[model samples]
Target chain A: MSLLKEFKVLAFLVVLVTGAVLVYAIGDFPDWGDPISPASEHVSSYYIENAIHDTAVPNIVTALLADYRGFDTMFETVVVFVAGIAVLFMLRRPKRESEVSMDVSGSPIVKTATRIMVPMMQLFALYIVAHGHHSPGGGFQGGVILGASLILMAIAFGLPSALKKISNKATVMLSALGVLIFSGIGILCMFLGGNFLDYSVLSAILPGTDRVMARSHAMLGVEIGVALTVMTAMFSIYADLASEGQLDQGL
Target chain B: MIWQFDIIILTLVIVSALSALRIRDLLGSAIIFGVYSFLMCLLWAGMGAVDVAFTEATVGAGISTVLILATVLHTKRRTKD
Candidate 1:
């Protein structure tokens, strides 16, 4: 059989199997938006109600990220930093005797479309990170989106252009800065006679009702930091892989 | 009817997994793996696991597929084993 025919057959079979599983599994599932589903009952509810009052953020996810489980966020940021460092270390080469220009040869249409999409993607990522305080998404999701935007730029324009926008040095610096900012918030809390990341004490430092807003603002700040670190780390890894043609060509 | 839908999705998952391992071309396998992830996301949604589905859609279908494709670009398309 032709490869295309085989592929089609395989695809059809896969679809059929997946449909079967869906039917069996969904029989036990609660109705969508039933609020009393296992997920809502298990954990998200506690965070949803108390998170707003305690953290002063309308977005439950953001509060969970920066306050309820701030320690996890810290470590998550560190993971990104480590991944960036690892990629840079592996891809590091002695200064080329002559700098090899990694230019892309692509159609004008593709290039134009990428140029249009890149900025829009970047904006969308920023929106996700910023609005995380009011919505379902938070740092990690937004960070991935941001990384994807850069990856798109690399595929369309060329690694060189993408590298110009996001250098290894810049990524490292930004990643470290993200960690620093996150830790700094913790330090600020400590200074206010609270444990690490104890945001309630932040109110003491601020004047009045502003305290709640300040704490929420602080949480948002950390979310941005996390987003920056993760996005860059993932982008760097993708860039390294693509630069070497790991997907299409031989390693 | 919904039960029928679930059964169909389950069948797709099984077949995709088997084909992913069976494919000779690494690129083709990676693409199929991506489709598998998408199917899994839909299944999760059907099972009322919206958060899991959302995560799967974004991380699995979105970033992971791209990352895998990048790795495929660096490596040979055909698997020798």
Candidate 2:
């Protein structure tokens, strides 16, 4: 007991010293919205000034994420896919004969309310994904919202009900499909004689569009791919966690 | 950001973070952590990063909270440490 007490005191002192050092270091940081700061003076300025001219996307964040740094976002989607697979491997158990389904359904009122809200939620998620080029949201956020709607269904009804809509096998397939969609677009760009993920070259295939519009359209396609992967992965993680990977009833 | 709103939200964020850490009940701790996440989202929105704020609200406050609650269902409600 005395040894444990001493360790706690030592930990607290270490934390204090670290905090003080970090606080002191913060003083050297540039002020908020400093135009001349290293971060804002370099690539940020380029993205801010030319994103619209290059990608025809009003939102610089979207252009930066889905166009300028598209390869990173594609790998990020793969990471989410891998994470879902890892959770499945770690926690998923084979269905057992002795397993029992738990009643997580709240009440009729809860069910009815969820039924009403789910459509609205799904619509809003779609809007977020579609409007991401002009607005604040994009694939990751929209996908999470979509996944949350499924989770809401699980909570109101039961895990079994939600599983019926998107089974375990479907989750894996859908997640993989998402990555495929993103990479497929990049491959198409390659086939069209452009560098991978270079959307401007896609204008050759997409009729009635110039280079800039083609980039914007290609970004939308990429965003959809990212959204698909993120939403399915999120739901798969929640389902595995809730059911202990049984895919049965969940709380 | 307005200084007053920033100060209040920052204080609440710190309080919620400390309480989430110090609470003995795992469920309460998870909920407090969600509150802290929501406050952080608000702070981000106030700082004019609406996109980041949106992500924080959805992933940090909403989905992560539900995920934690689901995990808590399988474990003991109280912490030993």
Candidate 3:
């Protein structure tokens, strides 16, 4: 172990040299707020200018993210789902070994605080998810908040209370459902004679709505699916890691 | 010339990060790192990148801190580093 101590200094020096090199190399890049930079002159301008017209979503980030580049977002959800599964596979104890003090809440005061705070957090998360078309938030941010609420419940009232509310089986199912909803929508669009995730073609299934309005509605649905997957993934990861796979005792 | 927010917040970030590095207790370092994350979130929000800031706030200050603290609780508290 002492031999490893000698390498710490070498590691620090390497990091310092790398930082200096990065600072020097950054001179080649354009300065902050440079108008003529490649990014500013590229597709971002098109996205900014045409996103609202094409998608009928006021939020450009939302439009570009959940609509124009929905395939990327769908895969990102899969990555989070994989992370949850990874934690479960790596640490979750066998069912027989998971029989410990699973229902012991932390303390009365903590429980009281969590009881009051959880609902508000959930409500706010819903607002963030629903209002994403007009605001800075979207599925990922809201889903994190929603998941945090469940994690808070676990911390305050023990893992059993949290798990009882939404069992591990449910989360596993839901994580898949979220990704399924996304890809399913894309597949449906394809079946309707449009490209994958081209929500404009979804008007056939929904009447009294034009193509733009259909796209707007479809974006919201995709965002909701994303939120569901993200929230469940976070919840599952927390449970698996905190309880060391037992799902019984956790902080 | 009112760089007051940036200067103060950046100073806080640097100070918190340094303290986190210096702290012998793993839990204390984790909490201080949370403070650093929060300050970095504020800096990102100030720069008008609200989405990035939101992610930083939720992931860095919120979930990662909690997860790391749980990891510390599972392991030893004190550190030679």
Candidate 1 lDDT, A1-251, residue by residue in tens: 59989999999999999999998998899886678888889788788667777767876656776887898989988987897788777875554445455456467998899888888988988887888778666677788888888787777776766777777678778878878888888899899898998777777776664656767877877888888888888887786676652222111
Rank order (by lDDT, best first):
2, 3, 1
Q: Which ten residues in a row have the lowest lDDT in candidate 1 chain A?
A: A242-251
lDDT of 1: 0.78
Which candidate leads the pack in TM-score? 2
Model-by-model DockQ, in order: 0.31, 0.91, 0.72
Chain B TM-score by candidate, in order shown = 0.95, 0.98, 0.95
Query: Residue by residue across B1-81, what tens digits does model 1's lDDT show?
Result: 288988999899999998999999999999899899999999987876554576687778888888899778767899985
Q: Which ten residues in a row have the lowest lDDT in candidate 3 chain A?
A: A95-104
Number of the top candidate by lDDT? 2
Task: Name model 1 segments beyond 4 Å from true.
Answer: A1-45, A95-102, A205-212, A245-251, B1-4, B46-51
Give me the displacement of residue A41 in model 1, in angstroms.
7.7
Superposition error at A104 for model 2 (Å):
3.0
* Model 3 ranges off by over 4 Å: A1-7, A95-103
Reference-based TM-score, model 2: 0.98
lDDT of 2 at B59: 95
Q: Which ten contiguous residues of candidate 3 chain B have the minimum total lDDT?
A: B1-10
